[model samples]
Target: MSTAHTALIVPPRLGEPLRVVPVEGPDSLKDLLGGDFESVARGDWHLYLNAEGTTGDLPANLRAAQLMHDCGLDLAGAARGPAVILGRDAKGKDTNIPEHLLRRAEELFGTPQAA
Candidate 1:
């Protein structure tokens, strides 16, 4: 089983500041993605687990795709404006993805964790 750790840095624009939150597995990802989950293909799926902590095994690429699907759904209702940051930490180093759907989450649902 493989595990990965990813962080979604939601920028403040719609109504909140910047927030850095980590997503461990599928369950934790669900909280950030909500419904509308699907399977990831190639670019749509990836992993970044933390070697220091344990969170079961990392979900499959398909699972990551599902999470991305959910993210898309969340973005549909998000306001258009500032860009949100979705960092994929593979070696614990932050790697930014150009086109991120999670940004919509911040625009639609104000940053609850930011507070």
Candidate 2:
């Protein structure tokens, strides 16, 4: 069975002053995504961050598609935005894709991890 953990892939064009926050479950994301989780899931389906302090092999994508396709932003313009942000437990405070579970997600999504 594939465990269903959520992730947030911010657009590559978002501006600075972006802060990582503890989001709830799919509902929170759905709310932010205007109730279209499928778009977020299928819109390139890329996670660009490399989980820290890990020895396991990571993905080696020379290029990845847009991180956001449903955020209603001109992706081409947000080139300087943060690359990616995965989900984690976040100490049970909010939704998160823990670094430990990152490899699993990588395998599931087939997205190359960041160097």
Candidate 3:
């Protein structure tokens, strides 16, 4: 079988700067799956389990959760509940925050929040 590759950019911290890691082959797939599939297959059965209830778009969710956590919010609670409450009007429609959460997130992280 032919091998496929993907790049994952890891954010920098206090001491570490940005990092780009190339993942390939089945290892790449494993990294994409976050080391669990069968568990993800199980419904809320793995709700409290890490790497479970995560797949396909998990990487994005994980990144968001991490950012939320870093921004002085409880990620676990958000995962369990709405960590960042999206504003809505009485019409039950989405409304934009004054400064916008994205801008605030950028200010907090010193990096842009994924759109």
By lDDT, the best candidate is 1
**lDDT, model 1, position 107:** 52
lDDT of each: 0.37, 0.35, 0.33
Quality of model 1 by C-alpha lDDT: 0.37
Error of 2 at 70 (Å): 21
Q: What's each prediction's TM-score?
A: 0.31, 0.29, 0.29
**Best TM-score goes to which candidate?**
1
Q: For residue 47, give model 3's deviation from the true position in Å.
A: 19
Residues 1-115, model 3: lDDT tens digits:
5432222222322332222233344354345434542311121111112244333333233443564455454445223211122233465432332234344445544543232
Q: What lDDT would candidate 3 get against the real structure?
A: 0.33
Query: Model 1: runs farther than 4 Å from truth?
Result: 1-4, 9-13, 38-115
Query: What is the lDDT ranking, best to worst?
Result: 1, 2, 3
| Order of the predicted models by TM-score, top scorer first | 1, 2, 3
The TM-score of predicted model 3 comes to 0.29
RMSD of each: 11.8, 14.1, 12.1
